[model samples]
Target: MSSAIAQLLDGKALSQRIQTHLIQQIQQLEPQKGRPPGLAVLMVGDNPASAAYVRNKERACTNVGIASFGKHFPTKTTQAELEQTIQALNEDDRVDGILVQLPLPPHLDAVALLNQIHPDKDADGLHPVNMGRLLRGEPGLRSCTPAGVMWMLQEYGINPKGKHAVVVGRSILVGKPQSLMLLEANATVTIAHSQTADLAAITRTADILIPAVGRPGLITADMVKPGAAVIDVGMNRVTEPDGKSRLVGDVDYDSVQAIAGYLTPVPGGVGPMTVAMLLKNTIESYERRI
Candidate 1:
């Protein structure tokens, strides 16, 4: 085995490159479009983490010349109210994308509200229509996190064709879509979840391993194959022994880096890519209008 540290999949730099390109594209199209592309991010409650994420998204929109039509609702906001707002945004001619921030109030039904978003404007790509389109390999908006992972792979020339790709997690949000994308790229995909027996055995067999189960330190060094590409999609905040909090991914970065040929860092890896893909989806929706 080659004694070299795994190459980092630097998502932050790539995300910036994409945003810069998008800025130029928007500048060129604004004249004919008459207005900047608009994205409506509807956020509910005061969840600190969600608030921070919303702020980051809106800031990214501003940087890329996209108009932010964001709305902040109180914790007690009812489901009916949010649904009405989504309907209005759907009808709004200026808005090209609409995303409802997740982990909504306990009383609100997130799935029902997501279903109400018009398929074309579903920027998060969680609507059943988009998911269905993905399953059929048809052209449609895709879930941002999974799409970002695919882009990262392609950027580094890591083709999945004819490889054994093991994805740990079966959530509709990331795992399912990610597996489908890999399959589309001609990889033999295996999805392992919480109930999968001998998880390490399955993971060690992967040429490309992706863990999106949102648990920290779940994939240890022994679980990864030597020289295999490891992608960490999990984002978990854990407190260190020194009483400091930090973000970590599913794979043990230090250990995996030594074993795998390529690995993505937690905060700088999949997180930035996720936001970048969201912006890309919104831009695509805007272009479709023209």
Candidate 2:
């Protein structure tokens, strides 16, 4: 008897393709009398992880030929000052998209600060208006992660219509919007959270299983249905064998790979596609504004 491992979903390749498409689209656009499409990223505090994320985003912008405006504040900065900076970015004509890194200093209100970005310039797609548009089935910017997930499915030729999708987290940033995006693709969606009873039983019924719960090894082999498409969105840090920290996902890759028909890896999976989609959204916002 032979056992076959699941096919790996390559997010890095897909992200590069998406970026290439964006670069071409951007080059073909009419050059206006204003500056290039600009993405303004606001970072508060000096969290190493947050700083790395912001720096990666800026690099991605540069790679795609999009202009970037970055604002970094010390950990002790007041909420009022941050809001003022956001307000200025919101009013700047050269700025096409505004993104505020998550997990701001405890004193700052992330929701309120995100709300300050105009809907048209919300690159992260977390603004109230953008979320509302997603819920209402209206035309607007889709959340980067959700959009990237959809892009992967399409690139891999996985049709969600009439499929059962189980989303293992209900986070606003990943789970909720992701479930909705799958539903938009005509898939029956079930969103599970910490309170859900018998999560393993629920997950086993899915044709597409997505784990975004932020807990490593939460989804094991028995939990995933055979031939199911698995997407691991968690990026939890865990101690490695070398006594160092490493990033892993919610799904137990070794165990689940034996059962799943398709699987996305941790760091190399959904991570790269996110920035690519952000560039896509920035270009989309630019075209719309122009």
Candidate 3:
């Protein structure tokens, strides 16, 4: 496989362009709404990773001219307390989007809290209402990461129609929604997971392969089809022999790059696109509220 056979999907560049367009849209819409679109990101615990993600989202909201109503809570915060906060934000006219950062403390019921967010303001698109809408192929806010993957595919002119798409994860956040999106685009979709038998066998059948399972390098070059479009949504942090940590995706990038026709790099890939879609969802909710 020659290097010329592969091309980077470049989600970071596309995400910046998305932010610019969002900024212009916000500026034009602010006068009529009397306020810029606002997004509330509720994060619990001192998990450094979740804190970093919240900060990135807030910064992106600021750059896109959207207001942030973010909140940070202690890991020991009660479920009822968090529920009350969500209810207040749901009714707050100033806020257009609401998101709960994932992997909440073990004591909390993440699904119950996510269910409480109003469907229209469900920015993360995990609420049962939003998920139902997605299942029905209705017009509603989409899951940020999966939506970003679809947006990237469109931007790169890689249509899923008539192609075979294998999504290797079953989480509501990325894999399930990702497979649904590909099906909506007329692709034949198959979903495999970490527990699936002969995972590599299914992977080789895909024209489009998206893996969101957290394990690093789960998708090796031998598992992929030549010229397949590989969009990696997994993010894992590992310590190197030098005692330094770095981020990596599910796909074995260095080897797979030589075979895939289109691929997204780990740090600059789906990560940035997820934040961009969060801003886009906020703006969409803002327009509908008016």
Off by over 4 Å in 1: none
lDDT of predicted model 3: 0.93
Model 2: residues with Cα > 4 Å off, grouped in runs: none
Q: How does each model score on TM-score?
A: 0.98, 0.97, 0.98
Which residue pairs clash in candidate 2? none
| Model 1 local distance difference test score | 0.95
lDDT of each: 0.95, 0.91, 0.93
- lDDT per residue (tens digit) for residues 41-79 in model 3: 999999999999999999898888888999999999999
Worst 10 residues of 2 by lDDT: 27-36
> Where is the poorest 10-residue window by lDDT in model 3?
1-10
- Tell me, by lDDT, which candidate is best: 1
> Could you give the candidate ranking by lDDT, starting with the highest?
1, 3, 2
lDDT tens digits, residue span 1-290, model 1: 55789999999999999999999989888898999999999999999889989999999999999999999999999988998999999999999999999888899999999999999999999999999999999999999999999999999989999999999999988999999999999999999999999999999999999999989999999999999999999999899999999999999998889899999998999899999999999999999998
Clash pairs detected, candidate 1: none
Candidate 2 per-residue lDDT over residues 1-290, each given as its tens digit: 12889999999888888888888787777366255788998888899998988998999888888899998889999989988998998898888899989998888889988888899999999988999999999999989998899999998999999999999999999999999899999999999999999999999999999889899999999898899999999999899898999999999999989999999998989999999988888888999988
